[model samples]
Every structure is written in structure tokens, then in C-alpha cells.
Target chain A: MGPITGEQIAEKLSLTRATLRPDLAILTMSGLLEARPRVGYFHSGKFPHQIVAKKIQSLLVADIKSVPIVVSEKCSVYDAVVTMFIEDVGTLFVVKEGGLLEGVISRKDLLKTTLGGQDIQKLPVGVVMTRMPNVLFTHTEESVWSAAWKLITHEVDALPVVRKVAQPDGSDGYEVVGRLSKTNITRLFVELGEGN
Target chain B: MGPITGEQIAEKLSLTRATLRPDLAILTMSGLLEARPRVGYFHSGKFPHQIVAKKIQSLLVADIKSVPIVVSEKCSVYDAVVTMFIEDVGTLFVVKEGGLLEGVISRKDLLKTTLGGQDIQKLPVGVVMTRMPNVLFTHTEESVWSAAWKLITHEVDALPVVRKVAQPDGSDGYEVVGRLSKTNITRLFVELGEGN
Candidate 1:
């Protein structure tokens, strides 16, 4: 039916209009149906899961990103590990003067370097870090769902949230703004479960 | 108003009953209002977020847990790291005969040990792992929301999904069954966003 009145639906189902009201209300509220003023109801062409997807996608990274833990490219791998411990973060952005992101280092990278039997005290993190253009990142304006997708598809524990900045060389550089991580996603999941 | 009819609500708002149907349906469907046959609508005493929370809380850990990556207690830290790399997991469960959980080890724990300048190749993972009775764990029947909450509260990357088994000594032992990690939660978040 293009549009069906409440009374017509109630009559078709052999239900009183009052008994049918809640059912129609549920369908409309869940976006499975749309009711027009004086025109009755029809399919909205949207599924119930789309409501959840829309809610999740509407959340921006800026709303939930954690403070970015940063280290200098010249920082020794030993110091980088120490910083990671002190900051209690899985990933750290390698930043230069003015907090411009140069690269990103993760616990996995440091662990692999440690297992290599190299002198961590002498090796700078820059050598082991995933350098710019190779580093996967997100912007504040991006949706949290998109960031989470990137984290999953790329198999990285975290992404540096950045803002574009015009560099002295006339190319664009990312200014480290925050961090989006699996931890943040887990926390958000908990929050959603809590009805927050 | 208790058990007010749609016509009464429409009259109160100076709108036709046809125009008021969708609004009432939204309120009733979101669980803020209850509709009963011949009784009209009444307050449900429920918040909208509760609907989302209930859906999330009903998801069980067994439905989404990943296969557990385990190692024996005598396994060296070097080999444990290698297993972690090969399995592509962040945490490893230390188990013994019958697949019982002995302890849990994380990349963070291994990284800290590496920085201590110890002989990782000779250091048994058992020496560095968070041992039994101290490890926080989850079971197959536990809700995913509760498991995610533990991940955030305990600041651990993963939790071993275990089951209680009666030991020969009249004690309870936990058999490692699966793994629940922040990665799982992130993946779930993406799945929800995709409306799957």
C-alpha cells in the first residue's frame, strides 16, 4: 500500500485501533515506516540497523579523541619506550618543532626493535617509526566510525588525529592534535552500553 | 495524563488525529510511552538511551571472542614475542596441560622487560606474566559490555575467555577458551557502523 490509514490497518488485522497504535508507533520510530500528516503511513525504506549506524557515524573524532602523546624523532628508542610507559599509551606521534607530525611509533615497532638485539639506547625512534605519508591518520572532522574502520582495516592500534598546516616548503603538514585508538573505541563502546 | 486517547491528545494540541499519529508513535516506540488496547498512552518510565544500552548489554562474549593464542610456561620471552608476531596478537595466555590458563602476558609487559636489559632469550615468560588469581578474566556467558568495561578499567589490552573446570585436587581451574581484546571491540564498533 502506498499509504494506509490506522483504522484500515486495525480492521485488516481484526485489531482495535488502540491495539494497533503502538505497533505503528514502533515502526515509525525505528525508521522502518514514515507517517505523514493526514496521509497515513508507508515504508521509510530504512532499516532499524541504519538508525544505529547513523548515530555512530554522526559522532566525530574530535568528540572522543584522546590527547596525543608525542616524542621527537631524535628521541632514543629507550626514551621512547619510557615515554610510552609514562604516558600509558600504545602509540606516540613523532613530532618536530611546533608539533608537526613527522612519523608514528607503536609498541609493536619498539618490541620488534628490542627483539632485534640492537642498542636501544643509541637508536633514535625515527629509524623505527612509520614515517609521514606512510603513517595512517585521521582528522578531527572525520567520523569515529571511519576512524575505527581505518584502525581495523589497517591493523593498527591507533591513529594520530591531525590538522592540516601549511608548511614553510609550501607543502601540507599535519599538526598532531590528538589520538584515536582501540582503547578509545572500547571506551566508547562501554559508554554506549552504559547509555551515556 | 494517564491513559489519554489519541483524539484527546490531538484536541489538546489543536491538531487533527491524523497529524498526531506519528508523534505518538515515536514516543511510544522509543519506550517513553506505553500504548495499550482501549487504554491509550501512558508514560513508560524509560529513557531512549536505555534501548541502545539494553541491545549492547545483551551481546555475550562467546559470540564475538577471538581464538586464544597460548604458550607454555617454560616458553622464553623471546619465543613468546615471536609467537605474538606470528599470531598477530597483542596478548598471549600462558597455559599448561589440558589447556588450562596459567597466566597472561602483554606487549607492554614484554616491552618493559626488554628495557630492563635482561636476557630475554633465557627469561621464561612465566617470570614476567601476570600470574593466576591476579589475572582478570571473562567467561563465555558474560556480556560483551561487561568485558569491554573490564578492558577499560583494568587498562589491559586483552582478557582470556575461560571456563571453570574441576581439578583433581578438588580445586577450580580455568580452561582457556578464547580471547577478548580492544581489537574485538573496535571491530564490533565498525560492524555496528556498517549496519551489519
Candidate 2:
């Protein structure tokens, strides 16, 4: 009911304790399941199928921005690169003074723009990112599958999950919450697939 | 089979021929099904699940570089924004004069760094864009699915589809090619699911 143990997992799937080791190794390395020695393997309880990846759900954009990271709107392209290295992240979220959702920047986006050999210190990141029209988003509680689908369809990476906190025209203030990616699904899947 | 005609499709699927028009329109727009002026609908005959986006293709890095953009490892952060606007790409690829890949930049990355007002314009992109310990590459022959998988697994937006055009150490030489994104797959899927 709560979490599946390694012994229980091995019994359910009919895999030998020895053969199961390899898959277990892969699963653990992939961040799917965790081995607890005496506790067996603990499932993170995060298995996602293609169905979940494509289903849309409600989201809060502010929740995502809440994660402590540098916030910017008009910095030099050079500065963006530095933050990426310092933070060790592939994507960065851009917001206004009020944390109004602006756009996003990713490693690929930066790489593509930097290839031009323009002065990085002089260039504004705004010139390079997939802007307003190109950005895809989701509501909090939206299906991971839906968020994933948007990523695929938009031909872009990462989706800002926002909840209508207070729409200016309406009564909602769009806020970014959780950031969803396919990696999350894969991590969950690997854990469930290899119970060893 | 050769191809499915509109009448045949309508009859076989039990849907009115007229009703199927919208789905057909979407499929064609996504570059999956081909229509030869009422020649019915033929599969794109490219990637399997061509109608549904089963396999994703690789990107040629060289082709991306050939798109006519400017990059600068040493330029001030302010100039990068100008290049991004002129290029009309969501991201940029950073590499050396000899075509060796370096780092990446995205709109969000720049936005975050600049928001705090740390004199980003004088900074080099090398200061903010992602550096080592976080780069992933894909070979030319690998399916787009593989690249997609990497994006999902690594929580990144894109992959450098490289071909070993020439390997100095005989390890591998990958020339970047074609860009594949989630949008491509999402578009294909919307069409595939259109069927009743």
C-alpha cells in the first residue's frame, strides 16, 4: 500500500536476485528507485506513462520561480552564460519585477546564439531566446504528459506551469509553479521497471 | 498498400468524408501525411510512426552554424541580444572557429543574470552560459527518439546531433545536423490521435 520493497518487487516480477542486479543498477543510476540495503528498494512513487506526459493539468507558475535562483530580464548574453555555469542548470526562468512570467532561456538557446561570435558581454539574452509567441505553458495540476507534449510540439524544451493567481482581465494572477520535463518521467519509469 | 484515398478512408473508418477534412488538414500541416490534390493521404514515408511521430531524427550542428548568426566568446553581454534578434532562433550553438562545440545560451539564462543589474553588458557570455560537466551529444544515425529521450532524461531542451565527420583521436567525430524538438512530436501525435 505504501512502498514496495526489493524482495516484494523481485517476487512480483519473477526475476532472479542475481539477474535483477543489473536492472537495479541501471534503475538506481537513472534515479528511478533507491536501494536501502536492509530496507530493499524504495519506489519514489513517480512512474509516468506516455498517457500522463500528454495530459494537461492546472499549475502555478510562481511555485517554479520560487526556487532560489538569479532572476533577470535584461542582462548581457555573457552574464547568462556565467549564471548557467555557476548554478549548474540547463534552463533559466525570466520574470518581470512583479515576477510576471516573461520567458525562459536554456542551454541550447544560449549555445545557438553564442555560435554567432558576437560580443557576449554586449548582447542581451532577449535577442536569443524563444520569446512570447514561441513559449508553451501549462496550468498546475495539469498532466505531466500534457506538459511533455507541449515541449515536443513547441519544438522547445521546458514548460512554465502556471496557475491563474489573478488574471488582469479576469480574476487570475498567472503564477509559475513546477517545471516539468521528460527526465522526470524517465526517472519514475526506471524505478518501477526494475524492482530488483 | 499504396495509399489510402479519402473515400476509402471515410468508408473504412465509418466517418463522413467531409468530417475527416479537418484531421487531414492538421496531419498535412505537421508534415506527416502527404496529399496529392485529392490523391487521398499517403504517409510521409520518412520516420516510422511518420503519421504519429514514432521516431525523432537527429540535427546537423553544421547546418545550424550555416544559418548565418554571430557568436562571441569574448563580447560584452549587451551585444549578444542583437545577434539573437537577427538570427530568429530560440537558442544558439557556441563553438570555436575550427567548429569545436563550446557552450550554449538561452533567453532565460540572460534574463536571470541581467535582472539583478550586475553590469552584465561588460561580462562575457562564457561567464553565464553552461560550461563543462553538463553537455550531452548525439550521433547522426541515432533516431530522433534517442535525442528526445536525452532531453527528457537530462532535463534539457535540445541535443547536438553530431556526425564523426573526422575524428582526430578516432574516438568519434560528430558534425551537428537537424534540430528535433518536442513540438515536432507533439504535432505528429495530435494528428495520429485525431482518428476515432
Q: Which tens-of-lDDT digit does each residue in A1-196 have in candidate 2?
A: 2455666656654556675566566445433345776677654333222212222122222322224233466877778888877876557667665665667887666765665557778888877766654567776555444555566656554566655566557744545565654344333222222222
lDDT of 1 at B23: 63
What's the C-alpha lDDT at position B145 in model 2? 50
Misplaced by over 4 Å in model 2 are A1-196, B1-72, B88-90, B112-119, B131-134, B167-173, B181-196
Q: What DockQ does candidate 1 score?
A: 0.39
TM-score, B chain alone, candidates in order? 0.81, 0.54
TM-score of 1: 0.83
Per-candidate clashes come to 1, 111
Candidate 1 residue lDDT tens string, A80-101: 9999999999999999999999
DockQ for every model comes to 0.39, 0.05
lDDT by residue (B110-172, candidate 2, tens digit) is: 656555456766888778877533557665455545555665676564555544566577753
i-RMSD values for every candidate model: 5.0, 13.8
